[model samples]
Target: MLVFSDLEDQSGIWEETKDLFASDFLYHHKLTEYNDEIYLDALDDIQEHVWNCGGGKITQYGLPPSRDGEKTSNVIRREKSYNKESLQKNVNEKMSLLNDKQRHCYDVVMSRIKNGCIFNSNGIFLNAPGGTGKSFVLNMLLDSVRSQGKIALAVASSGIAATALHGGRTAHNMFKIPLMEYNEIRTCGIKKNSELARLLQMTSLIVWDEVVMANKNTLTALDITLRDILGNNKFMGGIVFVCAGDF
Candidate 1:
């Protein structure tokens, strides 16, 4: 004979009581108890008064609203707010600065994007010594994708490197990959219904700068999480993935 003023307040026990029987009860009576026997007895009457408002709103436990406790909507908005015209202008200016070898790398990556690299194995690794403009080429690739009204994720293994790219974020922060040692089956901490998940689904390209510094397990965790969120078993959920570093 549990009593409550509002069902919403008892959301914690909602699922536990879903199967409870009222012993003998039916609607609009100020108190309705549900039991298999009573429910069957008053089936027709109960059907008349029953209407589905919708599923109860429950936030997933251990899930934060967004990365670093930021608002979910703010994260989503920031990802999509880049000006296509401005990005295109910046890309055009930067194009002329690329060396011949760098320009060739840029063309190869852009071709992958135009041809829908998601359906195929489109992964690139730029291995060169320092002072070779790896960051310059990575930035060019990011701008090209974003200028076309598509999402391009730019992340780096370290904070200093991440700050150099447009809209860049630390790889661990962006994907919620754990820092400590983890099992092979472990995935990132991203929830499927989270705002970060939505952004990942919409992304066309992912440029990881200084990727050589990241742990192998961190990369594997990202792979597992992306596949789960995007519902695609393909590598990195079919996003064009680029890894650039001196290693």
Candidate 2:
């Protein structure tokens, strides 16, 4: 049985358990012994509960997957507090650490993100060579937007570039951009109804670093997938896809 007292702990498992069984005390009582029929019954109940919570007929996966053969790792993470006041204060303090140029860039990005500039279907490319505090500004942008109940997808063209920011991953890894050399592989590895599609749809901003080095093929692949899922052919389907690089 999952630990009831630790439901609020940030781990994915306990959070999912807590979400599935709102009454921690009840689940605690239900788990008297391991492999007991009662325990199994409780498991079944929680599975059904999760399924029901997800709109009952596989709108998404918290329970059984919609595709039988599809494999997934449904990691349930407890989200950081989205208290705007608290986050704004923290962001302000972080801004103080930024140099003038960095602060200016951060402010512009923040304004655009908050005021729906991304809806214009034109992506922005910020160019600043190494040591211009590009990473600092990116971090600030991610934190500020994520704090205000928005999703910021951070990725970099290469593995090394990916490590510079929080929650960063390689563009290929995060967007499922395959390394195929031919244009025949048009769409990305994301399915319209899958969780990856859901994530892309939920994302309001995408920050890509080291764009100078990323293959054009890779970007094209991502562009195609975004268009398919977003139901439009415009840039990232009206989502902000900011590419940053410097000579």
CA lDDT scores, all candidates in order: 0.70, 0.65
The number of the candidate with the highest lDDT is 1
Error of 1 at 220 (Å): 0.6
Distance from true location, Cα of 77 in model 2, Å: 4.5
* Deviation of model 1 at 107, angstroms: 1.0
Query: Mind sharing the TM-score for model 1?
Result: 0.68
TM-score of 2: 0.65
Q: In TM-score terms, which candidate is top?
A: 1
For model 2, how does the per-residue alpha-carbon lDDT over 1-247 read when each residue is reduced to its tens digit?
A: 2222323333355335543443432332223333333333333444444454542332233333222222332311112223456556778787779877777777677666777654464578889878877787887887788777778888998888887866678988888876677565676788788767877777778999989897677787888889889887787776877789996
Q: Model 2, poorest ten-residue lDDT window?
A: 72-81
Spell out the clash pairs found in candidate 1.
Answer: 21-34, 21-35, 22-33, 22-34, 22-35
